[model samples]
Target: MNPLIKKLADLSEKKSRLIIGLMSGTSLDGLDIALCKISGSGQSTTVQLIEFVTAPYSEEIRKQLKRISSVENVKLKEVTYWHAKLAHLHSEMILAALRNWKITPEKVDCIASHGQTIYHYPARDQQELMDPVNSTLQIGDGDHMAVKTGILTISDFRQKHVAHGGEGAPMAGLVDQILFVHETETRILLNIGGIGNFTYLPAKNQPKEKTFTTDTGPGNTLIDSLMMHYYNKPYDEDGNVAFSGDLNEGLLRELLNDDWFEEEKSKTTGPEFFNIPWLKEKMEKAGINQDELDPKDIIRTASELSARTIVKSIQQQKITSETAVIYVSGGGAHNPYLMQRIRELMPANEVKNISEIGLSPDAKEAVLFAVLANEMLAGKGFGMEIEDESKFVNFGKISFPD
Candidate 1:
């Protein structure tokens, strides 16, 4: 047998796996490295976050990533170069994490990487008549990661989902269903990264069709973009700037008028859709002078827009029952204003950080990737049967260390 195949088979027999899950989101804030010990799979999946750290990207690195991360014309050579460059950087981060935890790379079983999403164009928009294909690209070569880290790597998980007719997003739903769902309680697993998305896991008694996930529009992307352009801050830091400013209702309404909001559920979007240019266009439409507007007000409205869109999406679900709880993760959860507003909007539903459960809210996304990787190695694969029937699709492409 090939050494790689034998090693994988050996791993499958293990009771658990020490997997390093890496997630670099659209926020470009940092690379979230989660050292996870995952056991079992599917509904029986369990994960313990052994260690975690967010290695912040230098401005130069961030700029290079952003350059290749949108519809804007970029050099193909640059994109090709950064794909491996990012993988090398990620490997360095992984090594740093291992050193920090006083562990050796050999002790780890595998690396599950979400990679860096340079573009996401889900096929939800058929009316456009331009192009209709579910396409997404996440760089950071898994082969390079595998070679550099000397660990079997599973990366580019989204491509499989797209190939299987999924929107290539909210893939965390499977893990959430396995690890976070309650027997009787309907739970909303909300992740507010650069783009906000949630997995609505109905009670076990509910029909499986009722269990769905969708992107709830802007998360921190709009606010973060404004902060960067205006204040030179990557983020609002707990939304203090937002708290200090009054909401601009007119601009808020204009921002909320995007057709993306009215589109069908289970959709996905990114900073590519909700960034500064998008906001400026909305302001222009609303007859608001972008130059004259106070920076704080813009930030305040962006934060409120995020909260409102989230609430609107939840409301669309129409999950009526006082037993539901909203478990929020991702950077937006740290924003007190956003959290308070979400709670205010949905007073009946209990809103809490995922930390109240076993997983740290900050580590949830990385941990989720780890869970998916574990499932690929050991558990029964997922058969998604919602709008379409997808059979036993195992996400992630395996890269052998050799």
Candidate 2:
């Protein structure tokens, strides 16, 4: 047998495994490296976030990523270059993080990389195509990561979901089902990342089909873009700009008029559909001239749009559980104004940061990918069922270090 296969078999049989999960969301902010000690698999899975850190992307790196990320057109060479370049960069960040944590690569079992998403053309967004199909693209090659880091790597996870008849996103639902389902409380694991999305985990006794995940429109993407364009900041820190500005009801309504909101609950989206251009289009439709409107007001309106769409999506679920909990995570959790809006809109349900559930909100996305890699290695069922038999297959593609 190949020594690599033998090593993988041995690792799967271990009592516990140390895995590094990497996530770089559409925000183009940085890579989230989560060093996790995960044990068991499926419903019995346990994840201890041993260490977590955000490896900040330099402005140069951010610029390059933005050029290729979610844009309608780009030079093919740029995508090809970043695919490998980003993986090496991620590998370096991981190695540096391990050193900072006083650990070594050999001590880790695997690396689960949710590579940088350059384009997420879900079937819904591909109307122009003659034969549209659900598809998404994430760079940072697993082969490069595995060879450079000398650790087994699992990357390009979304393709499997698309192949299995999913929109190739919001993969968080599977992990949430395995790790967060409650005995009596219907929990909504809301992640307000570059694109807002949530996993609806019905109480343990509920039917499986009742549990699903969907993108709740823009999370921080629009607001972050506005900040960068206006304030020259990466994000609206604490959402202060939004809090200080007055909301434009017309603009908010126009933004909500998008047909995407009315789509099926189990769906996915990305910045491609909810960027600054999209916001400006909505603004134009609302008759709000960019020259006259205060940028802060625009930011405020965008923030409200995010909050309203999120609330609207949750309400659309028609969840009968008045006691359901909305555990918020992602960069939006840190934005007090955004959280305040969500809390206000969702008064009945308890709205709390995911830290209340014992996982760092910042580390949750990265950690979940680690759980996925663990499941791929040693798990039986994915803890959920879909009509597609293809969905039952292991998610991440494996890359072995020779």
Candidate 3:
């Protein structure tokens, strides 16, 4: 028997595992490395975030990725090179973090990497394609990570979901159900990264089938794009630009006219569909020239558009009471302008960051990956039967270090 396979079997039988969860989101800002101690699995599982940090991506790396982030015309060689490069970068970050924390790589059982999402296109979004299949890709070769770090690794989680007929996103629902589902309180886990997404958690008494996850559209992607284009800033820090300018309701309305808003709640999207080009097309349709709009106003309108879609999606759920708690996470939670608008739109609900529940907003994504890896190691029968022939299942492909 192979030593790696034997080691994995031993890990599967262990009562606990130390897993490092890595996330490089659509923002391309940095890598969120979380050293998590996870014990048990399923409803009984527990995660202690022993260490966490955001290792910033250099400006050069960010630029190179931004150019090819979601475009279809990328060179195969570039993609292949970045796949290994990201793995090496992640490995270096992990090693540096381990040194800082005085822990060795051997202490860690696995690395759950959410790699970098290059593109995500569900069937609905690719209706024009002759063979429109639900597809998504995250590049950061797990094989390379395992080789560099000498730890068993799990990555490319989304591919499993797509293969099983899911939108291949908002995969957080399984982890949320495992870790955060409340017996008596209604909860919504809202994550606003480059894209805004949420998982609705009904109280135990409520039908579990009612619980679902969906993307509420743009989060920081559009605003971030405008900021970079107009101000040479990566993001509108504290939403200062939005606060400085007037809200253009007309432009806001134009932004909301996309068919996506009215589509089924199961839909998922990314910066690909909400990029500057899409915004420009919408502006033209609304007869609003780019020159006529101040950069600040553009940022403000984009911000409001995000807020409105979020509110609309939550409202569509029709929770029995206004007392449901909304735990916000991701980059948007830190943006006062965005938070204020969401609060204003949902006045009766309790709105708070995930930190209130003991997870840093910035660290939630990485931590969730840790939970998924734990599930793969120790969880059983996570698949929940849905209307379709497919069932929601545990997702991750493991790579062994040789």
Pairs that clash in candidate 3: none
For residue 330, what is the lDDT in candidate 1? 94
Poorly placed runs, candidate 2 (over 4 Å): 205-209, 386-390
lDDT of each: 0.86, 0.88, 0.87
Clashing pairs in 1: none
Q: CA shift at 88, candidate 3, in angstroms?
A: 0.9
> Candidate 1 lDDT, tens digit per residue, 288-390?
9988889999999999999999989878877645788899999999999999999999899999999888788888999889988998999877554443425
Candidate 1, residue 125: how far the Cα is off, in Å: 5.2
Which residue pairs collide in model 2, if any?
none
lDDT of 2 by residue, 1-402 (tens): 988789878987987899999999988889999999999988899999999999999999999999999998999999999999999999999999988999978999999999998988987787788999887999999999999999999988888878878878788888888889888788889999988988877887675536767889999999999999998999999888999999988888888889999875577888888888888888888888888999999999999999988998888878625778899999999999889988898888888888998999999999989999998888875657522223454877999988
Q: Write the per-residue lDDT of candidate 3 for residues 1-402, one digit (tens) a residue.
A: 988778877887889999999999888999999999999988888989999999999999999887778887898899889999989998999999999999999999999999999988888887788998888989999999999999999998898888888878878777888889888888999999999989888888777446777888999999999999999998989989999999887778888878888765567899989999999999998899999889999999998998999888767766525757999999999899999998888888889999998888999999999988888887775654322325645668999888
- For model 3 the local lDDT of residue 343 reads 88
Write down the TM-score for model 2: 0.97
Off by over 4 Å in 1: 125-131, 207-209, 384-391
